[model samples]
Structures are given as structure tokens and as C-alpha cells.
Target: MPQVFEFKLPDLGEGLTEAEIVRWLVEVGDVVAIDQPVVEVETAKAMVEVPCPYGGVVTARFGEEGTELPVGAPLLTVAVGSEGALGPVGLVDSGSGSGSGSGAEAGSVVSAVGSGAGSGGAGSGSGSGEAEASGNVLVGYGTGAPVARRRRVRPEAMAVPAAAHVTAAAAVSAAVPDAVQGPVAVVSPLVRKLARQHDLDLRQLAGSGPDGLILRADVESAIRALTEGAAAATPTSASVPESVSAVQPSRPSVAQPAASSAVERIPLRGVRGAVADKLARSRREIPDATCWVDADATELMAARSAMNSAGGPAAGPKVSVLALLARICTAALARFPELNSTVDLEAREIVRLPEVHLGFAAQTERGLVVPVVRDAQARNAESIGAEIARLTEAARTGRLTPAELTGGTFTLNNYGVFGVDGSTPIINHPEAAMLGVGRIVPKPWVHEGELAVRQVVQLSLTFDHRVCDGGTAGGFLRYVADCVEQPAVLLRTL
Candidate 1:
């Protein structure tokens, strides 16, 4: 007999509470090595492939793709205590499953399974004895010990929208097959999850799907039957409906849905949910103010062109406008350090930061993400530009780590790429200020006291007023604008 240890969804750091199963990498009875990716989950932070810590035969898997599971919920089960423990990615170090993406460390848990309890959860693993487990499983978090509690499945976890239910029901009715008895005709893992939640035995209920496939409707119907029978046995006094049955023929079964009243419900999860929560928190906690100014970006443009055109192929990577602006932000923060610090509400003290971690907003296919450059104050424009390009590519490819997305002391949002003039951007929470740059275009401007056509751009600064007064914020914005107009002013700090 093999020992079965259940693997639960490990907390992928950054205070993320839940994750949706994007895809499953292993199936039941498949041989999975230690530190092999078993499932890919999408958290509020990023999409990560969770590596299983145990090396054994996969016995069971929980939740379907698109099903959201709370942190600590069971992910799958592995039958260990066998020979030939394989290392999928590379060398496994002392029970740490450090072979998959980011080298996730799965906890070392060894629990002997009985004859029929292969799919038992954490608590059930130690049915008759103590289940000893320890160590971290995720990138930055874990129980570090065996902490098994009875799992309570939330109703909303397995909830399907009314529209989806109707659609599934329609699909079931449209298909009918010959009555054939074979393996369990279950197409969706969600139906199994729903049944487990309600404690309804799926084996007892007849499926209505084609080829007798056990669908969600079948589980729901069985649950309804149990609920109705339980309610009837209670002998509760109810409102009499004896006369309503005779009049039922005159009335329709259900009110027809109004064509205009149809609605599609979209769950705000993953990246979208994270953005919403952060923006809302920033609005609630920070007293922010926005100030805008139009600047002459002609000189800045000329400088970038010259630098990129200089030294030919030996000039390395071309400097982006955002990188130059990022460098400018670092210089401005040195002078106006007040806008670069966050407020400590509990102590009510303003702590000015020494180094500047510059964050810039990048719009990807998923949503808006801010990838932070570790230290902009220490890097030149070329270095900053190269880093920004790297982070942007990671954002587009959805490979940015949580550390790259966080720990920003300041932010630069270049809405110029969107062809917009200016925008009062919501300050990224915990960060004190954000500099928004609009598209630069050739416009008539006063050059050397003469009206002439020059490249002009609009810049907006939104800062947490609690951290700095309007005067300090204005000074910071003005210095950035000055650097744009006269690139030589930035040379002084350089």
C-alpha cells in the first residue's frame, strides 16, 4: 500500500486569497515527479504553474479549469512511498520541490492512505495517527507545519451564473444518445465539486446528459429532491395553495424574459479584480490632488534622436521617451523628496525614502500592470530604457513576478502611447505620486521669446496630498516639466 498525501493550493504570496484553476497539468494515475507542475492557476497577482512537492502517482485532482479555489483548498492527491522518485525540472533538494516555475517548494507531508481513502483531504490523511508535515510550498508562503482543518466550500466558489445554467440546460436537451453503460459519463469537474458541496451522492442520481452524462442539472436536481424531502418531513405549516392549482391552467408556467432586460454577468477576478481593489483602496485612503502643465518637449525629442543616432551600432539599445522621463522623475524626486514618500497613518509620520524604485504603467492584453524598475536613481537613461523594455515584454507575455510588480516608491504613466493629451490617473496604492505624460505633437509655441512650431506635450501629476502639500507637488511637476523643456537642466543632476 502507498502513502497518500494531499496537496492543497499553496498561497502564492502578496496577500492573495484565492486562485482560479486555469489548467491542469497532470491527470489521475499519471506519474508526476517531485517539483513537477501539476496545475496552472491564475491569482490576482499573476498566472503561475503550481508544482507538486511529492513525487508519486497522481490519484485525484480537484476543481475544473475556470473554478476558483480558496487558498488551502485541496488541489490534488499523490500516492507516494514508491520507488523511482523522479526529478522533473532538475535536482530536488531535500524534499523541496524546487524544479518548476520560480522553483516552488512543496511541503514534505507523508501520510499513509487506507484501502479506499486515496482522495481524502488534509484532515483525513491522519485519520488514525498524526500527519507530520512541514516546510513552504509556494514562492513565499506556506503553513511550515501540518495545519489541517475541515474545509468549508463557499457557495460562491462553485456558483454558475443563471445565464450559464440556462445555456447548459439547453445544451443537455439538444443532445440525446443511446443508453450505454460504461465509465462515469461526467464531462465537467464542476458538477462533481457542486455535488460534494451539497453532500449529494452523484452515483445515486441518474444523469440527464447525452449517454447518461452526469451534468450539473442532475446534481442540482438531486439536491433539490433531498432538500424538498427534508422540508416535507419537518411538518412545517405553510401557506395553502390548494385553490391555486385549479387556476394554474389559465396562467403561464413562467414569465417570459424581457428582451431588453437580458444581462451578462462577468466575474471580476484575476488581474481585473486586483486593479479594482487597489484603485478603490487608493481612493478611500489617500487624499490625492492632480495638477497639469503643458511643456515644450521639442528639446527632449531632439536629444533622444541624437543619442539614438550617435555611435551607430555601438550605441547599444535606443533610449525610450519613457526611460528619459523615468530618469527625470528620479532627479525630481531627489530635489522634492516629499512627493516620493508614503504616509504612516498609525504613527502619523512621513518617512522619506532614499532610493527611487520607478514604476511605469504598461497596458497588456490582460489589463493594466505597473512593472517597477528596481533602482532608477542608480541607473542612466540607457539602463532605465533597457529595463523598461524588458519589463514591458514580460508584462505582455504575462511573466512578471510579484516582486517586479510591487515595491515602487514612485510611478511614471506614459499615456502618450495611447494618443491622449492628459489624464488624472489614480495613484497606485501605497505609492505617493504618479507622473502622466501625454502624446507630444508639433504645436505653435513661444521659442526664445518668438512664436514658432515646436513639439509640445501635456504632463499631469497626481500625488497623495497627505504625503505632500500642493506646493511640494507643484515643485516636483514643474521640475519634471523644466527637464522636458530644457534637457540640459537634467544634465546638472546627471
Candidate 2:
């Protein structure tokens, strides 16, 4: 008998308590190695691929994709020492063997690596001879290992007809209805829910998916058949042909509403929900005030171009405008440390931070996210640029961990990317100030004692009034503007 170990969702840091299942990487009966990511989850902070710590055959999954599970909730069960794990029972309704599909049986073992595990030999997926516990995994996540391969089932097992197992499971389900739903030939919980909503007998319909797997569209078609047939004939009359009506669903309660409910409700539970909560909290607690200044950014643009072209052919990666601006923010923060502090409301005091964890806003398909660059004060422009680029890519791909998105002392939001001139953005909660940059465009300005068209940008500083008076905030914004208007001014800090 294999010792079954249950793994719960680990504590994703930064005070995240729950995560929504984005996708499942492994299915039941697949062999998994220790520290292998089994499911990708989206938490309040970021998207994370959670690794299973126990190496063994996956027996069951707790929640379906799109379901939210709280921390410490059961994630999956692994049979750690089983000689072989039972395969999913093949299921087919009484649909004349048309779409009946076959899955591996209980006596077979699936392999995780190469073409070898397809043979179903005992004790596979461990990489070693036997399975073992995971080591050196960062809490809640693993160090990036080679990506796990999907397990393969035996070819011969798939050739056998599904009816044999269906009849057997039918008999077994008679006695143990809870343990087996005949594996149902349906993989999606949403499809199962749809079938249940209409009380449809899944055993009667042939699946249209590969190997007779039931799909949402197939279930929906069944529902439409029942609905159309019901509407064509009154409750007192009419009929469907035996051949066509045989597969038609018996239930009709969920077909449609007499009235159309036009309102579309989108649940705010994931990234969008998190943003709402944070923004609300920031607005309620912080007495924030905004100050704006327009600067001639022509000098800053020229300095960036000169720096990028200086080394002559091998000048390395060009420094980005945002990166230079980040460096300037750091220098400005050093001059005015008050903006680098957060108020400890409970202690009724302001705590000045020593190191600058700078966060920059990035817009991604998932939503707007701020990936923090750690110790920005310690990094030069090139280093900060590289880190920013890496974090931005990770954010876009939804691979950023919760830790990378939090712990910021200040934020730099460049709304200029959207072609907007300015925004009074909300401060990220727990942080004291945020710097907003508008688009740098050619504009008429007074330069060198004469009016001329110069590359110009709008800079706005939104700070928590509780932390400091306008003097400190204005001074910080002025220094940053000076640096942009005259890049050589930064040399004093250097």
C-alpha cells in the first residue's frame, strides 16, 4: 500500500491568503516528481506555479481550474509509495460504441520521462530508482528546475473498448457510488456542472472530444435539443424520433428564462479585485496631495543618447529613458529621505526606510502590476534597467511571484506609455509617495534664455500629507525636474 500524502497550498508571501486556479499542469493518475509545479495559481499579488512537495502518483485534485482556494486548503493527494496507480476508468454511455474511449487501467503505471514510462513499470517519475521528498525548495515555490514532462500512458491500453470498464464501473458504482462517478469521460468541472444543471444522463451521450471526452459544446448541444423539442410541442403534445430523442436530455428546467437579464456581471475576484481593494484602502487612509511641474526633458534625452552611444560599437545595452529616470528618482530620494518613509499608524510614528525598493508600474494583459526593483539605490542606471526589463517581461508573462510585486518604498508610474499627459495616480498602500511621469513630447519652452521647441515632460508627485508638509514633497519634485532639465545636475550627487 502506498502512503498517501496530502499537500495543501503553501503560504504565498506578502500576506496573500488565497489563490485562484489558473490551470492544472497535471491530471489524476499522472506521475509527478517532488518540487514539480502541478498547478498554476493567480494570487492577489501575482501569478504563481505551485509545486508539489511529495513525489508520487497524483491521485486526486481538490479544486478545478477557476476555483479559488484559501491558504492551507488541500491542493492534491499523492500516493507516495504505490507500486502502481489506478488509471482513470474509461466511460461510455449506451450510445452504440460510437464515442466510447479507453483510458489506462488501475494496474498500469504511467511514466513521466521519455518513452520509457509509457511501459507502465512500477516506481516511475522519481528520476532516481524510488520516490523521495523535495529539498531546497523556496517556501511555497521551487527553484526553477527543468520543466516536467507530461506522463504517457500505454498504447495498448487505449486500444481496448471503453464499454468493458463502463459495465464494470456501473456494477462497482452500485455499491460504492461516492468513490466512483465512472470517471464519466468528462474532464472539465464546468461541463459536469452543465450536465448536472439539466439533470442530463451523461452515460447516454457520446462525447465529441478525443477518446470520447465530453466537451462543453457537446453538452450544450444536448441542452439545445431538449429545449427546441420542448418548445416545438406543448407540454400536452408532440415527440422526437426514437433515434434523435434517445440522446436528447431528459431535464429541461435550466433551458432559458422568460425574460432576458441583460446585465453582465463580472466577478471582481482576481487581479482586478486586488487592485480595487488596494486603491480603496489607499484612498481612505492616506491624506494625499498632488503637485505638478513641467520640465524641459531635451537635455535628459540627449544625455541618454550620448550614454548609449559612448562606447563606440560595443557600448552594451542602451540605457532606457525609464531607467535613467529611475536613477534620478533614487538620487532625489537621497536628497529628501522623508519621501522614502512610511507611517506606522499603529505606533503613531513615521519610519524612514534606509534602502529604496523602487516599484514601476507596468501594464500587462492580466492587469496593471508593479514589479519592484530591489535596492534601486545600490544599482546604477544599467543595472536598474536590466532588472526593470526582466521584471517587466515576467509581469507580462504572468510569472512574477508575490514577493517581486511587494515591498516597495516608492513607486514610479510612467503613464506616458499610454500617450497621456498626466494622472493623479493613487499611492500604493503602505508606501508614502508615488512619482507620475507624463509623455515627453516636443513642446515650445523657454530654454537658454530664449523660447524654443524642446522635448518636454510633465512630472507630478503625489505624497501622503500625513508623512510630510508640502515643502519636502515640492523639494523632491523640484530636484527631479532639475535633473531632467539639466542632466549635469546629477553629477553633484555622483
- Kindly report which residue pairs in candidate 2 clash with one another: 86-106, 93-203
Error of 2 at 56 (Å): 1.5
* TM-score computed on alpha carbons, candidate 1: 0.67
Tens-digit lDDT string for candidate 1 (1-494): 23457799997888989987765776544556677788877777777789888766554455645558899988876655423211111111111111121112122212111111211121121122211232211111122222232122221322323433344234222221112111344545456446545544444456768876777766766655544444455333232122211111111223324444634354566788899999999999998999999999999999999998889575778898988999999999999999888888899888788989999999976689999999899999999999999999988877787788888999999998999998999999898899999999999999999999999999999999888789999999999999999999987997
Residue 462 in model 1: shift from native, Å? 0.9
Tens digits of lDDT, candidate 2, 168-217:
34532332334222335765545654665565766567787899887888
Question: Which candidate has the highest lDDT of all?
Answer: 2
Q: What C-alpha lDDT do the candidate models reach, one value each?
A: 0.66, 0.70
**Cα TM-score of candidate 2:** 0.71
- Model 1's alpha-carbon lDDT is 0.66
